[model samples]
Target: MAVLLGPPALAADPAPPSAQGPAFIDWSGPYLGIEGSGGASFGQHTFHGTMIGGRAVPDFKTGDATGRNDRSRNATTAVGGLFGGYNWQTGPWLYGIEADVYGANLKRPVASTAPGLGYEGLDPEFSVLRAKTDLYGTLRGRVGVAFDRALVYATFGLAGADVRILATYPDLAGGGVASTRHDLSYLGFTLGAGVQLALTEQLALGIDYRYLDLGGGGRFGLGALPGAAGGPVSTRDASFTSHQMMARLSWHPAGLTPPPETEGTSSPDDRFSLHGQTTFITQGVPGFRAPYTGPASLIGRQVQSTTTATMMLGLKLFEGTELYYNPEFSQGFGLSRTLGVAGFVNGEAQKAGAPYPKLRSNRYFLKQTFGLGGETEDVPDGPNQVATRRAIERVTVVAGKFAIGDYFDANSYAHDPRVDFMNWGLWASGAYDFPANLPGFTQGVMVEYNRPEFALRAAYTQVPKEPSNDVLDPRVFERAGGVVEFEERHVLPVLDQPGKLRLGLFSNVGNTADFRQVVGLTQAGLFADINDAAAATRRPRRKTGFYVNLEQAVSADLGVFARVSANDGRNESLSFTDIDRSVSGGVSLKGTAWERPADTVGIGTSMNGISPSHRAFFANGGVGLLIGDGRLRYAPERALEAYYALSLNKILTVSFNYQLVVNPAYNKDRGPANFLGTRIHADF
Candidate 1:
């Protein structure tokens, strides 16, 4: 079972003494932050016999009929969310009111073999019990003792959660499956204690433990099965409780105001910065012509959704050096778990596990910049950037865990998936096949030389240990990916509009199979499956590609963009999508003419193709990372997408979108699919 609520307050140690005494560190202000939690839950569900219409019904059984007991399972979950509070202090005593909301993924499946009432012999029945704790919130009162740098406290609160339980019996006596679903909005109680430590006036870190009891659990009727006599059975009692441990980081915006300047001390504004953004998307394909299907084909007439939250923290270590860290939480899944399309639909979706919430340290890196004595430009405060001025001609070096796409192949009109196009091929060069781990990230080093007219950038990154694996290869130098890009900025002669053209080349040396080799092995009967051929022929191979991107402002309220790319198709795609060649173009229009200046409309189209060898491999039932329908009738994959976004405010926007895809997975025998989507995004 899944449980939600934040941890309590108590400190492991007292705060260090200050020169001006405990009062010098005030515990009076408002603060906001995020927390991550992990723990296990224990609970059980019992079934009881029922008497309906003067007839007795048999109780359900688990394991064996002779030994009947409650169905129970222990679940471990990782949860995360945002929190805020205000505090006041009176001498050594502190009090506050805090609120928080979090989400978790916890579930269990049970099965058994039992004798059927209608059938003479034993029959197999299985049930999947899932508790989707989508959102949980708490309003609590805190009391603690402040010790200048640390606080020890206890908290009690009112907690609530939106929980749903889904149980399915797949093999009933009558032949079809039976299921019962319950949606619950529960109000509960929480109590706990923990400690917090202040690393600085504006930043604090804490850890705590808590206990939660949701309180509404008991026997309930589940409607009858088709051929059963007594109508549906009921569970005896089903309750949930959890003990959780959580870690939190808090920031006080007011505390960020610099204290009276002291000799040789840096200003607080220059030392630290924080920013965050969130996006929620719901997408569905109403229907498609699916004549045939395989393991990776997209399913029609299904809606799926996802939500992502990211917090960026940055510290200026020195005059020209900065360090940044991003903590991100993501929930939900893409259509068909993000498969079946070479140029996939959503860039935000990860090739990970089932649809569930997860927390990850997405990016951390150190950057150093050196001025090259040119004109300076003022940069605004944002994630990974400080509100400062920098030379137009400068050199920057960065190293650590990050995404290669974060710095390279950027376009003004089509780069950011959150604000621009959602298709992978449209936002990024489809044929580049950038190296990354399961969550689309990598450890790498990048260097850039920038000037007003042009910029040169290069990087070397670690590839996955194996194709599409979550872990990176330890032999990064031996199995690595590298890229170099040159960007030129210019103004259109007659229109006098700003534009940029970027040319980039990329190469990856990794353990990949050759499509031709696999096809030959399969044709010769040396291998029954292309995957076996790939395994047998796995060796270090070099894959190379090039791309050209163009972005131009056609008018004050209109922008246009285009991309062309191609990669060698001899070897298997080591990362990214399966396209060997790609071309995409699009235009964006602001709603100024319609008097809604904050609104935007966009239209785009793309065509993706594979080499003859690659197509032959798929036609023979070969599978790639993103596409492969067991078998194929080869054709180019083409897609058209359009969207309209309306801004509700400066911090929030909503958009409606549609996409039409032809020859999905490059298989002409399958679908020309249509998808509808809605997106809500917020940045602060």
Candidate 2:
């Protein structure tokens, strides 16, 4: 089971106009507030040691031992704090200092297995081991900045935290045994950058990121039961850092004056809109290894590269609507030019000798979306035809559509969703913000459906042959099925706080129809039901899956997040051949990477796994940044991955990535397999 905490709390009131000595008190005020954050987090920690003090006596012979190594962690935290400050607003400068004390429930877990590898001589009485940490703290800070309708600020402070650790060792004798627990405390530092763009005198929206660092070289302990590997021993000290990033909507009551009735020119059309990011990847051939050349010249290497582009276009459709579009392309320049053409057969690569054969030499990644809706403004003077003054000023509703080739999310399995890279679908979404009543929060809902392409259906039925067995033989197979998706998101305020909380839930259902036609030597009565002639005409059955994510922000520069996803699927026609289930969860940190104003970056990672395709467990992460003025441009930071596998071949692997530029490169070396790959990605 997984639980997500809300975001962190920001200062109750806005900072003063100036941080200078006692002069103007134009911006001096006090207020009490609480806040929580919601997002995602990545985990990285190792647990490998023996146990002690059990019934196994001096030998410490342990039962229920999960002697596995290399695992990942994901967790979230909810922070509540109270703060108030005085501000002296002078000319075009605003600066002040605020202090806050916070209570946090942070989740950080480390999983390990040892003293019982592969359950050899191991008792089911003690099969699993898990660890988690709960923490809380108080923070003090001083801030400084300059500007009027907009401002740029830098803040620094010190924080104190207490951590509680939980570890469970399951019993092999049907039921589980009581576990071990530990607690500790530490001091850390926090720093980051933020910007605010005021659209109107009383309404504004902003984004921020923060970084936190807990001291290093803190030792921890783990001992075996009485009969385990000679009691327990002292383990290495634990250490790591975190990042947090967030987007916020703010509104102020009793600040703006009422607009004139039926006046001339009204306030300049004040507009506040938000845009999402889009990324496309194109792959012409399905081969992991380099294209095979002539018989003897096997000196070639398997390589893949994608040419990706991202752009921000003005979104405006009619009086109150938004629309946007972006497209991409990827192809094998060197490999395709050398081997002529290649074909994909059962996740394998085969070569050909021809200029642009029947196969598609080009692949495209495309996406198009738009919405119909309206916005709210503080000033409702006459010239402004679309003006309304209600306690809940903005009840913005938007509906749009989208289509894509492959709808694989970055956090899922490394491989594409379907064996092949092809899919197309559409989506409709809507969102609303309550400024007067709710202060700093928004509500949203979305739904989408993607149809399975013609080729994808063929590949699933084991009929993806050379000239497509469908052409020469009309009795090949029936059309595969399509997928339907439904989702919902909630942005709630942390009571009477400064920051906000976000929660999301999504589900997918895929329907597979029975094979309608058969090609070669088959009697008409042979495969009446797809299950009977499973070998020749295998079709699909209906399957459904779902996932959820929750995140929260503690302050303008600090936040914590967590996410959990699960899926269940089956291909009934082939004797329920491809029936599988998977679940994963992890935590994340945003902002606080750099000290300079323009160097804000977000770093995060997570751990999880599925059956069959996965032998053991795994973890992964991503880092991002806001680069341009008004944060119009985004940049990649870093990504990390580590996993352990149990199978015919056992091995521990570690992978690292540096997304320095929009197009980042990845270098990996695992046993006999070694290669370089470049990839680019974005989220809307």
Candidate 3:
């Protein structure tokens, strides 16, 4: 995905005028919207010529060993974007100009489509070709007619896109793979039509169709493949066209006012709460030293970006009961698709990434609180939380799909990646191996007891079916993860500063193979493959760990935090990253000393180690959840992160960050990488 995209600009406009005719919908004013799109492509694809080891073949038919052509295959996928425009309406007629950019994954694959000439035995070879477009944008003019609360419109626009072509095939002569890649900028045009229905004075819903014609002309150098030498120097061209359908919702800035400044500090009466937020983060790494590479080693250079937008809805069902649901849209990829580094540089990156935005219900849970009859304290209004007074000593129960991190291992100075830290080692316990799906979310039941001096939390949740896998197990009790944590709060004698200490014990029960077991079995010939050992050993197994988290406030404007975690290294990591033991700590400073009270600065560092068997496993060519250098030089992986945040306004903040990773994935031969990143976040 493009790394330059940031969050859309937001502004408030006066409510649409009702003077036009109180009852007639006025389709004029500046409006912003979010859309979900899905579409397909229909275009002609072909191969013009071929050459094998300097020998030219003027005419060759494209086909594979199967005697079939899947090239020019139909392309279908989903897309997401944001749009804004200003409209002017006169009676039932309206005109406007709009601009929008989308996250997209449009690619077609061609395989075994070239022929090897003049090579007797190496005939019927194989090669692969991929045409990819990650992102595109449009600027269009719109004309529409309004009939009461409904509007019909047509749009025409200029479009531009990022295009890439990749081809890979076997090198028959050298017994290796030969590849070629071409990246370019494409300019095209779009035509579309749509209808909108006004749902309220400041809200509307619409659906539209677009035909995008991104004409293309590019050629690739083909390689020699095994069914004989497929080709040493072959070339092919490209064509691009797509039909897209989109659904959108528009909102006026005045539709939802932000919470007051004192919302979280003072008590307020509240039965319902609605809030929304979005964050965009982009990262890049410059060139570095790497004498060699493997399946899981971080490349020397790369840039990537990700975007997420979420809406929170909370309602009080009764006195001590509430329900909350969070819906979200996420797009883009992590560095190297979230591989190579043990403590990855981007905490927000997901292992399962999509070329376009994907929408899903992130959290849906029911919470009930039981008072134990003590002094009461006011809880703030925010995402998934309602403003209310709760007993200082109480018991709370939550059930449904959620993340276990919501209730445990919290450090005021370093917990949330969105606000404080961007490194996984800093924001979470790298060795905890907490249960989760690809996006780090799981289904579970959690209970907590809170008192003025201390708190105890516990939960049982579903885990991924296998290491490096995205799907969570459906049988909760049969394959589950559980944890218990205890936290103590105290005040320092002279500074009178507040501080907390937490200790957590966790365990996972699944069918994961022990590192030693797999290696030993493969050596003894009992197992056919070391990588497939987990399937052979199907009995239940347990992995356990413990962690200590500490956070203290040196003053109202400064805080320091530290964490130490360890887990048994015999079994594979059930979730989380690829570390078996870790220690991390840091200090945070607010700019009050410099008269910029809204700014913050922080520095943190971590060292991650693996168990002997885990190290041996990797040295033997076995791969883990986040690491595997094919071979290992065996060293503890170390990471350092530093960041600064500037509050631009009440609704937005911008942050800059830098990281140093030494011996990534515990391999000493490969790196000492430097990564730089920027984050833009908005909340209400």
Candidate 4:
């Protein structure tokens, strides 16, 4: 998120803007920069005698008291931040002031045990120390000497840091462990020197080293002992120092002199556009409910990773017709082959079953638009769009092999699993069981009518050849799915923000088994297994469902989204998950208050349930694509997820996510689980 502060560079300077050129480099003006550093911190702490009953216990010293309790630790760290400053230049001397803040992962823990400090046969003495430096900032003044295209500078600054300390004892007399944490703020000093080289009038790169001393001997009392009620029995002092080296990239927008005008003008070919994105996600559930008596219980404590790369190419073939193609490469499997949870943890974790990377022609489509004489809007050239003006009142017809979700059930905030919520139910209407292949796509045709305030959309897509099949049925007339949706967009006058609401009706016809039939056959003892009965009863069953979606912008930096969907549970799930009903909602917040506008935080929850017939089949040992806990203690599957995404730069982002799932697989007998995830994504 670095911003260049200078004007455009002059193409024809009296001389070239370089060290060897005739023009002298100007090191004046304000600049914004970003820096990354990797370093280590060194620190030491000293402990005093234990305090009990508001008095020092002579025999309870940590280690004979003469600095024997002193401990030292070192930690490796990584830090990154943004910086802004202005430089004043007079002749060859340069002076500047800069301010910056950084976030760091720097922590160390120390522990010790004492055998002689026990009370009533209980070892009541243990010392545990934990210290960390989470954040730090600097306000500095700089002095430098400038060369033609380079500058060498020295800096001194007032530095402030936040440090955390924790002390704990395991054997508290009555029961649980006793612990206390202290958050300390320290003001110190920093000194550094660096050299910068101008790559252009607007861009420069530099490397710098700094020594930071966060002062020493900040004393704090440790109140209460493990076995004895006390106050101020022991005291501790903590300090930290670090040597850091960072590489910086700075942009001076005001220093960029405009280039000379050229004689020829070339217009971009806006009719053709290409865009691509790549996302890599790794997620793990450290522990969950154990394996059940059933055949398809979830495997607890597992890690899985997935990667997807997609290239979207588009061409405007005619005034009202356009064509799009998306070729994608995908690798990796979901946790337990995407099993155990009715609402799976990762939406992008397709059922590809590929142990290695596989390439697929994911989508190809053609769209034609007819204008009905209305306001015009400019469309950006990206992905499937061409840079052109489009009539607000238009009818569009699309025929393609693509994911039905690409057009229908679209949500402005929650639909994209790559960027927004990642759970299956949160990303789409789970119970719709929309037609698709194993990777969630199918050949489809759609029609849409649009206006300033409302729109109507409908689509019919090919269903899988069989239940959970990896290929589409191909006989679109016999095995297919259709959906129609109406959308309304309006402004909330009170909030002064735009919002959209959508209602959709969908139906799928596929060679699927009826849940009640499977249960009925199992009870009749005609077949001992419900799956066998289900296979015997396979036929083209029609499942109908509907969904409601809403997205509201509460403010410029916050938004809310919600979805509720349900389907008739008579037929087996042909695509997507096993849930017959689902409701999900969440809010996304941008980090504008904290000043990192590119960062985002989101929290969401979903509840999924099966119909009576579907539950009975599972209770009688029937398995769907992802879930089958043999016998069922039926309970709705519920999950809560939250994530924080930090934008390292324009093309890269790192996100940390956590999900708590209750009654995974809709089996009350099985666990409430926890899933942690990390995602790295890049787009261009």
Candidate 5:
């Protein structure tokens, strides 16, 4: 009974502190900044039940003969959104509050054995179910201590959420469906600690951790939800919580300059710098599904939850414009390196390390990769964290290109936009930087490709469909089709400044050429061969996508940029190919108000939408700000942003959101929301 959670879309923690400058308007003045981020969410729940009667029959322990309890569902979904806020500082103790709200998606499906709950007693076993969680905003307070080159801070706040509970029941004696829905309010608290470590006058490194407590929560029946067996049973509400940790290496907008007094004879080899960032995060969501009201065939629902993680390492080699790789280090800053090696690992799981009751939801990626393999790197969204653990997994290499371990196909655009981070595959990509004969803008082009695979893991300790089953034959791996993509970029001087244009082309080909289709029967006894239907076809599937971007400074406080992308996905199975495309564009604004210690303010926004789909037209965008000076740099951290997405056509959509960041998730199983929704991350 594995429960797949949501994607990593929203971070449970608030945004990071802003970088600052001066308080007055002189050579340097104080300024504010804002930012927003998005990712996949992978937190979820699960529940189970036994037949007590009805369609389960013979009173074999299935439950009531009325056919009121005996159904179940295993549900999972990929969700994402945006949030933003503002910040202001006076002295050492930078102080500010921000709010982030989400308007994206919340989906939770279920899987079950019992047709529905068969409640002959006051408490029904478990069967049909539904889980829905949505939130309005998170308000936070900030306080911190500052040292000459360092600062420590703490934050606290409340998150208001709008949640809905739904359960369905099937008629066993006859044929029909019964369902109920509940709308509720939830209150929670959050706390986090962070530190900034200054490495040089112009560079700094930092790490932060945040904890979120959603309190003891649950709905009616089972432990808290009502039992379908008979009368009302003592029930308790479900509770959810998360924790996150992040590290970053940052550079000031203004490059590091040497002291005027030592300018003349300063050493020429002393101006190099480097930085690194890593993160771990985790979180969970739990609840129950009811099946007693309508359809006599409906099965009862039970309790369930899921945990996941996201691990990333980013390296920055800051040298002068003419950057090159050092053979000794096998790494390059800006120049081409003869050869180099890099590592990338991403993992995810449902009902990770816990017990599966009855309710469950399966992710589409997991269903597509259950078997039929070519390589792990062919899946569109990359690899599931648990799948890369296979001893045979190895890095992929092609002429003039190098990829560490397994990689994702860069060209698979057909499924790119809908893919969730929770079930993401792993990838390793590398390319050589070419020497250019251009000036002002650093110009280089490299060709690269990736292979993305799919796989997942869940706890087998839970009760099996057949009692006495000790060793549950857990599904260790699955194969999804693969993709290949090529990318190229050239930086150019726009209005005497640096900007650039990037171009990419890709294709997704099913690696079933030499693969076999494999299917398994779960304890629940349902055919889990969903992946074989559309993915393992003898006909091939292909996808191609492209994008172009431009960035320029309109003023010290105004910047503008635009990007356009298009994708074509063709499935040969039905001799019917679906062409899906999308285009996005946006801008950025940056400047400082009273610059001191390098504090500054910034804002950015982007507009994106998909061209065609079976759904509707969609659009999304957000804004953000920053407060502290040189507090944290690089690390790709965003302070605040709000975005909205909506469906206009059967396959097109529009989205909007507002976001604020106080803290982020550290571990996949107990961290902040990633904006992507619920996610699962596993590691060896």
Candidate 6:
């Protein structure tokens, strides 16, 4: 809301109207909420491609279950979204206008492409037909009847969705696979109903059901696949319909009765807040030497760009309880399709590529803090955190969808890639295979005990069922990831400036393969699959690691940071990169002496290494999440990164970055490569 109301100031909340027990439900007000949803999308997926030098088959339909093009397509997804509206109440009748949007997980995983699956398994080099709804939203009108504190309502609206369909076929003429992807926009109608109960005049809990019909429409061209110039070009379309069940916790900024209060310090009764940011990055690499390449090898010469925009919305449910949602739009690809290097550049890029800008909810979480009698600190208002007076020593619990890195292994000088170091190894611990989906976020619970000098935190999150899969394991508590960290704040003995040290340990149990075993299996000829043998031997296993992150400020404008992390490289990488061990450090300096206090310069370097088994896997032609050179003259991957960011304004910054990567992919045979990039960021 700074956009309209001006930059936020520490405005104290007025005492709420005295509680009246919701005797007469007041539904007239401005409201907003974050909701979680689960549902099935049953629709029709149509191929609209033209094949050349191939059979002139009608539609060229495949994988329709019924072996027909007219049959419905089915998929399931867990979703999160945000909605807000203004309501008018006429006695017991209530009416309002609302809008909402959701991001979906609708990818089909290719578990074993290891020369296995009877010659029909999904392969890494090629793909069968698959479709995903990246984003969808609605503009609706709502009408409901209220009785006491309960309200029953129905909603109908206009809806739109973005769908992407992709597949690949063998290009016999070109002797390569022809990859094609089509993105579609569908517009239709939606109708939904729900029941809500007001816990207090300002708070409500509700369950909603929606039926959305994204009308079958439009066709998109795939253009010829990059490697298959003379191959068939393709087009596709999808008609979507979904049944969604959603649970919402809403806050009415205008309330007839005040909410009940309990112990602990509270912020201004301001019910909701908003913050936003946008970042654009473009990078390119020049020519380097390479006699051969593998599935995950990076191209010697290539250029690519990525863009992201996000809006953070937060709501205060009551004292000590708050909810926040982050809706994001992302587009473009990482260099070499985000492969080849353990410390791949561009943390802004998601593992899942988006050919076009797609909107989605990346984070939506609820936080409840329990305070013990202690000193208070003034917490500034930022994206997800609201300005408030909070206990210095308290217990805080957060549950929902969020990035594990957002809460763990934090270093003021090197943690944020968007604003600081861009190398994965420089920005993160590099060895902790933290749980995350395609977008670098996972659902979980995090508990933290905070004090003035020290803090301790623990987290448990859903893990991916398979390495690099978009879908999460259903067994949240059983097959999941857990992390615990101890953070200490101190002052340098001589400098007396502030410094912090964070020690973290992480463990996860998931369906994974040990690198040693996968190599042994292929060597013994049991699976006879040298390609991703880990895929064939994947079973429930545990992987653990620890990290030490330290940040110290020598002067008011100068700070230094370092991280040391490692994991037992026996198992194949579950999430993040292929590095089993990593050490990274950096220094950051403000341009205050130069009269540009907001400007900054950062220089950092990292050495990333993999275990013996991991090296053997690559030597055996096994592909990994990011690095696999097909050949091995094993050495640690080393990189040095430096950047200078200039502040254009309070909310805008432009940065120039350069990175030198030696032994790319840990292969001593490949020479050092250089990466150059620029980033533009704005936040308010």
**Best prediction by TM-score:** 3
Q: Regarding TM-score, does 3 or 4 come out ahead?
A: 3
lDDT tens readout by residue for model 3, 622-643: 7777777778989999999999
lDDT against the true structure, per candidate, is: 0.73, 0.28, 0.74, 0.75, 0.28, 0.75
Model 2: weakest 10-residue lDDT segment is 425-434
Off by over 4 Å in 5: 1-494, 511-532, 535-540, 572-579, 591-684
Off by over 4 Å in 2: 1-31, 39-72, 78-92, 115-131, 138-152, 170-176, 194-208, 222-224, 245-684
Global Cα lDDT for candidate 2: 0.28
lDDT of 2 at 224: 43
Candidate 1's error at 489, in angstroms?
0.6
Q: Write the per-residue lDDT of candidate 6 for residues 1-684, one digit (tens) a residue.
A: 232123212112434557323333668879999876432222334433332222122332352222123323444455678989899988778899999887777554211121211224334544445667778789999999764445668999898889876655555455666666777788999887766655444666565667788767544445553332343433334456765555577888887442222223335555666677666677889988887887788887766667676779988788789999998867567888788888988888773266434678899999998989768776656779865667889999999999998899888999877899999999999998999888888998999999989999999999999988888898986799999999999998899899999999999998888888888888888775666567777888999999999999999999999999999988877888888999999899998888767789999999999999889988887888887777788999999999998765344567999999999999888868899998866665
Error at 249, model 2, angstroms: 9.5
lDDT tens digits, residue span 1-684, model 5: 011011111112332235223211111112122211121222243322222222222223455444233222322223223333333445555665645454323435432323334533312433344556655356776666543344456778886656565655554344465556656666788676555433433333444344456554443442222334332222134444433333334444443221111111212233322221112222221221221111111111211122222222111122211122211000001100000001001111111222211111111111111223344332111222121111223322222111111122232111111221111111101111011011001111222322233211111011111111212112212211122333232333454543433343433332221111211221123423323322333333333454443445555544454444444422211100111332323333321332211211222222222122111100000000001111111111112332222221111112222222212110111111222122111111
Q: Could you tell me the lDDT of residue 599 within candidate 5?
A: 18
Candidate 5, after superposition: displacement of residue 74 in Å?
12
Q: What is the lDDT for 575 in model 1?
A: 71
As for TM-score, the candidate ahead, 2 or 5, is: 2
> Candidate 6: global Cα-lDDT?
0.75
Order candidates by TM-score, high to low: 3, 1, 6, 4, 2, 5
lDDT of 2 at 406: 22
